[model samples]
Target: MSRRHLAMLTATVLAAASLTACGSGDEPGDGGKTLTYWASNQGASLEADKEILQPELDKFEQQTGIKVNVEVVPWSDLLNRLLAAATTGQGPDVVNIGNTWSASLQATGALVEFDDATLDKVGGKDRFVPAALAAAGAPDKPPAAVPLYSLAYALYYNKQSFADAGITAPPTTWEEMAEAGRKLTGDGKWGLAVEGANPSENAHHAFTFAQQYGGEWFDAAGKPTFDTPQNVAAVKRYVDLMAVDKIVNPSNAEYAQNQSVSDFANGKAAMLLWQAAGANLKSQNMAADAYGVAPVPFLANPPAGGKQVNSMVAGINIAVFKHTKNLDGALEFVKFMTSDTEQVTLNKTYGSLPAVGTVAADPAFAADEQKVLAQTLATTAAPLPQVPEESTFETLVGTAIKELFADAASGRPVTEDSVREKLTRAQQQMR
Candidate 1:
């Protein structure tokens, strides 16, 4: 299937905590004649996605007279395929990847540097959210990948839970959120929601919370910064919500991408923290008019210099592999995919918050739900550190946080100092 389809299906089938990378080159393709490009499981399968995406591919063939040999690999297999290809130079000519992979993949020197002039031929940075583009960039270098689509974290709440808790509206601060959560708890329901198992989601959510608490994951040099005073303090405070506050779901110890969203959607929880509100709510077919989405709650006491950092910014990025024999043809395909025309088509076929600024303004993503998302991506965005060590750090931090939550769920006394000690252990591994 297509990448978008894979994204949705993977939500139900795969744990959000994953390590799927694309474009390995360890072994070669069947015959070296075709420009074999591999992509992720966007929908049902490669063949299924071809129904929507293959037409686009066909158009490219007609326009450029370049035949693309396409392979659809499951997200589960993407990392292995890319590793194989990277080792053997047998990766695809074009690939779509999670924004988080930019740092790790780039560090291996497996991809080529993105050129500004060339990117302009594709969709320019002006077309995408600054932070989304930034995620695909080097610390001080220009972006390496062209974002194909984007998402931003927002607060999705169950109206029933809010009403039951006597909450007129969603909480506006972490302290107030805790109070609301407690009120919503009991009666076989959870107040707050989480993706505890998946570091892909957890680390970002933690980072977003850290921003509100005035924390940074990496220092100026892009080294591990989880041990920073602010980060440590923020993490301890966050973990306490489940461990000490007792407002979160105990089962959250193993949540992933859409799990929390599912909780809120099904009315099992009061709130879900995530990006891609509309797509994730999975409420498209269901009549969830009772659902309400809003910006993340602000911190009660503002950090000295930190603004209210709400949600993590994320997106799908498009990159042209260096080894594609059809350089000019591949370039044309890239331009077509990112162009305003293609963006419009993509939004309809697979609904995502679009990456291009103009397309975001289009009527397709026009509902109040989508409007707020676009705004978040444009203004509230804070790019996660674009460094290779980031994913590794997330895995370490996530495990500790999960343990803390488990302790809290069992009514154990969890302390900031204890979390700090855990951070120390994580720091050692990260380094």
Candidate 2:
């Protein structure tokens, strides 16, 4: 998200577009030919994803008379691979991208911008959840992608642990969460698990916490506000779980989201803040009845300025490449992927929610965890900031939190002064 990284990405996309456009003789029409797709791995493995999605692609091909080639890309390599294709002008016709990267990727002009006419081809903006749609691209710009899948964070608590601790229900506010943590901490288990080592995970929780404290990461003009008093307080509250409250393990400074979630599933921790982790828990042999889901905690008594907004719309989007030789086929493929039947089948395999509002009416989504998260995405979630530098914001803020955790783990002093000092440095670096 650094300007340097942005510059590098732009250069890669532009250079690739130019070279491919000049080097290749194929015009911008598929003429009812084959289409290549780069799908993010949504199942246990690449082969597993193929097993789940190839049938759907086969359906699309049979119905549309277009042969489809899919390459399942892992999460770690998707962006870099896309960048390489962008730079070389050899990327797939369609791709899946993290929604947070939509605006950033759009700025490169290597993606097909979905105008009103094209949007109608995919059932229009009205078909999708407004929040998820908003995240497909910047507000002022035509979207380069459409919402394909959706997710939102919620508190996942161990039901048995809560009952043993004499807690009747999941905590609805920060005060109660802390109290619950205290009660749940005495049996060789911590009350909460945190992804202190994962920048993206930490940055997301920071966003929710900052909003609850009535703080904004950016001004209307998109200036960094990382050092605001409310933001400082929110961050201090997060670190205190380890430093002051002693409810989180001090060594959690090295724990990523997967590790934290694993701890929660294995009963090493009583609570976890996660998004749609039901499948992973099931994989770990945690029974469906062993856990309960609730809204992420917010301030019980939000100070005069605080608000109760709880989550950010978190998920992936479907995008088409502008340089594809088969533009029409690519468009058709996008439509097929977003269709009601495909949406349900695909999201079911991914353990995520459908991006389309009407596509979510199935009773399967009414189960406890899915229902709570779907409700949160509909009622309380906000999109991450749409500015071009949003990724930069994540890296800076997430790194600062990681540093704070390291201080706690090392038994160093963690005062407000230290928090302000680190945050101020991050703000200055953004300039």
Supply every candidate's count of residue pairs whose N, Cα or C atoms clash at under 3 angstroms.
Answer: 27, 1
Q: Which stretches of candidate 2 lie over 4 Å from their true place?
A: 1-5, 8-36, 41-51, 65-90
lDDT of 2 at 38: 84
Worst 10 residues of 1 by lDDT: 1-10
Best-fitting candidate, scored by lDDT: 2
lDDT of 1 by residue, 60-146 (tens): 768766556567665444543453444344457777767766775565555666777777667565766566677885677666577
The Cα local distance difference test for each model comes to 0.67, 0.81
Q: Write the per-residue lDDT of candidate 2 for residues 233-272, one digit (tens) a residue.
A: 8888888888788778776889854678788988989999
Output the worst ten-in-a-row residue range by lDDT, candidate 2.
18-27
lDDT of 1 at 399: 68
Alpha carbon lDDT at 315, candidate 1: 74
RMSD of each: 6.4, 3.9
Error of 1 at 53 (Å): 4.3
lDDT (Cα) of model 2: 0.81
